[model samples]
Target: MHEAVLGIEHPGAYSSATAGTDTTVELWCNDHCDLLHVGGSEAESVVAHVEDAVGVRERIAEGDERLLITDACLKEHGDDPIEATLAEHDCLLVPPLRYAEGRKWCRVLALDAGNLTAFYRDVSAEFPVVVDSKREVASVRADRPLLTLDSALPDLSPRQHEALLTAVEMGYYRIPRDATTAEVAGKLGVERRTFEEHLRRAENKVVAGLAQYL
Candidate 1:
C-alpha cells in the first residue's frame, strides 16, 4: 500500500474564496458530499454563504467557528474533481482536507502504488495536483498511526486487551446493557469473575492513563 499527500486545486469551490483569507475550512467526506470544519476570523461569513448555497447544505453548528457542511458536487457550480477521481481509482482520502492559498491539501491511502500513480495522472490532467509526500505506508513511522485502542493503551496485557474488546463488542459497556458479564464470559470461555477481573483492570489502566490529560 502507498500513502501520499496531495494538494488539489479547487477552482470556484466555496473554500477557494475563503482560502488564505481570515477563514480556515478543513473538510472530510461523509456518506455523501464533503464535511466542512470551519474556523478563523471570517468564520461567520463562510457560514452565511454556505447556508444559502444551492449545492451546499449546513447541517449543524456549535457556532460560526465549527460547522458541518455537505457539498452536493453540483455540476453547475464547478464542484471539486479530485474526490470523484479518487473514488474511481479506489483511493481513500484521509480526513481533514485543509484549505490554504486556494488548494485543498489532503492525504490519500492508495491500495497500491499503481492506484496512486493512476490517481495522479487522472487528477493532474484537469487541475494542478501536487504530490507533497509519497512513500510505502509501512515506511511511515508514527506513534499511533492507525489510531486503534491498543495503540492508545500500549500497556494493556494481551488477556486484558482481549477481554476489553470482547466486552465492548458484546455491549457490556453500553448504557442499559445489551449483554451481561456472564454472557461475555461464556463467549470468551472464561469464568464470569475472571472476565470481570480483566475488564476492571483494563478499565482502570485506561482511565488512569487518560485522567492526567483531562
Candidate 2:
C-alpha cells in the first residue's frame, strides 16, 4: 500500500478564512453537512466568514468549533477536483481534511504507487498541488492487531512533520546539539522563526500524545 500527504491550493470559503492568517481548520463532511474544528487566535473571525459563505443552510458554533448544515457537500461542488479524481483512481481519503493558509491538505491511501501518482497528476491539473510526503507501507493482514504506531501518533501537519524530521536529521536534539534552529531552518528553506514555530507545535503534539504512556 502507498500513502501520501497532498497539499492543494483549493479555493473555498474555508480556505478564504484561513488565508493570510494563523488559523487552521479541520473538516469532516458527508452528503449534507460539514463539521469543522477551527483553531487559532482568529477562530472567531473564521467562523463568521464561514457563516456568510454561500450554500450554508445553517451554522452552530461551540467555542472554537462549528457544525454547518449545507445545501451540498463541499467535496461534491460541481467544480471540485478531489472527489472525482479520487474515485477515478480508486484512492481513499483519510478523514479530517485540513485547511491552512489557503491550502487543503489531504491524507490519501492507494493500493499502489502507480495509482497514487496518477491521482496526484489528475488533481494537479486542476489546482496547484504539492506532495508533502509519500511512503510505502506493508499490506494490512486480517489477523493482525489494529493498534500500531501510525494509529497512536497524532496527526501533524505536513510542515510540522517536515520541521521535526529536519531537526532530528540535522542533530538538533543531540546531546551536543550539532545544529541550531537557524541551521535547520536554512536547510528547510524557511525563516528561523517559522521553523521554530512548526517544531514547537510538532513537539507539543508528540509529547501530549505520549503522555499517558509516560
Candidate 3:
C-alpha cells in the first residue's frame, strides 16, 4: 500500500502527474469559501484517514475556519449512496469535484451522527480565477445560446439519467421553482438526502462533459 498523505491540495499542479491507483480524496467542509481543505492520498485506508483528519479540520474551522452549510443543500444531498458509503468509513460527503478552465464551484461536508452530511453546494462555470502574473480572475462567460440537448447532454449513467430528467420534470430549475427537494425526493421514492446526491453527481457529470468544449 502507498504511504498515506493528508494535506490541502490544489489539482492544478497534480493533474498531469496523477496516475491511476493514486487515490487522493479531497474534502471540504461547509460552503462559501472553504476554510478547511481536508484530503488524503496514497493510502489503503484513505477513507478512514480522511474521516479522522476531518475531525481536526472541523475543530480548527470552529476557530479559524468559517463557512456555513445551508440546511437546504444538506437536505438536498446528505443521504446519497456515496454519502452512506463514505459515512461507513467516517468520511463526510462534500460538493462535486471538478477541474476545468473557467468554472468553479464550492460545496461542503461534515460529520454528524457518525454520518457525513453534505450541503452548501454551488456551481459556477464562469467563476473568476486569478490567471498568470497579472492576477486577474478569468471570465469566460458564454452569452451564447444553450446548446441543443442532443449535443450538450452527456452520456448519463442510468441513475443520473433518471435524476436529471426528474429534476426537469419537477421544475426544480424553473423560475419560481415548482417542486422542492422534499417533494421531488418523494416522487423519486428516495430519501431527501439520497436524491440530492444523485442530483449532485448528475450535475457534475453534465458540467464536466460540457467543459470539454472549452
Candidate 4:
C-alpha cells in the first residue's frame, strides 16, 4: 500500500480555529456529525471560534481540552473536496484528520502508487498541497499493530495526556534533557507542580499498561 501524509491549505472552521494559535484539532467524521478533540493553551478560544464559525451540536470539556460534536459533517459544509477527489482515484483517507497551523493534515492510503499520485495531482490543482511524507508499506498487517497501541495502553485523563505529549514534544525525555518540567509547565500555562503531578501519573499508567508486553 502507498501511504501519504498531506498538508492541505484549505479554509474552513477547523483551519480558521487553529490560525494564529497553538491549538491543534483532531476529528473523526461520520454521516451525522464530526467528533473533534481540541487541545493546547488556546483550546477554549479555538472551540469558541469553531462554534461561531460552523456551529457546534455539543461540547464536553476535559481539563484544558475539549471534545466537540459539530452540527454537521464536513461533507455538509462542502469541505469534502479532497475526500471526493481521493475517491475518484480509489484512495482511502485514514482517520482522524488533523488541523493545525491553519491547515489540514491528512493520512491517505492507496493500493497503487499511480492512483495515489493521481489523487494528489487532482487535489493540488484546487488547493495548495504539500506532500509531507510518502512511503510504501510492505505489509498492512505489520503496521496494523501500531494503530492498536491506543487500545493497548491505559486511558489517561485529558490533562495527563497533554502533559505527557508536551513533555515529549519539548524534549524533556531527551538524553541530556532539552527542557525542564518548569519549562513544559510554562508552555502549558500551568504550575510546575501541577504539570509534574499529571506527567508522573501518566507515566505510571503507561508503564503499568505496557508491563505485560515488556
TM-score of each predicted structure versus truth: 0.52, 0.67, 0.30, 0.69
Model 3 Cα lDDT, one tens digit per residue, 14-121: 221222322222323344222322121232233233333222223223221122222222223233333334445454322333221212222223334222122111
33-74: candidate 4 lDDT, tens digit per residue: 889888766889888877776679988896657899988776
The candidate with the higher TM-score, 2 or 3, is: 2
Off by over 4 Å in 4: 142-214
Q: What is the C-alpha lDDT of each candidate?
A: 0.69, 0.79, 0.39, 0.82
Clashing pairs in 1: none
Best by lDDT: 4
By TM-score, the candidates rank as: 4, 2, 1, 3
Sort every candidate by lDDT, greatest first. 4, 2, 1, 3
Q: For residues 82-182, write the lDDT of model 1, one tens digit per residue.
A: 87888989999876566645666767888789998998898889888777677776543486464433324424544677799999998988998999999
Where is the poorest 10-residue window by lDDT in model 4?
Answer: 142-151
RMSD of 3: 19.5
What is the per-residue lDDT of model 2 for residues 135-182, given as tens digits with 9 covering 90 to 100?
Answer: 777756577522347557766655778899999999999999999999
The clash numbers for all candidates, in the given order, read: 0, 0, 3, 0
Residue 200, candidate 3: Cα error in Å is 0.3
Q: Model 1: what TM-score? A: 0.52
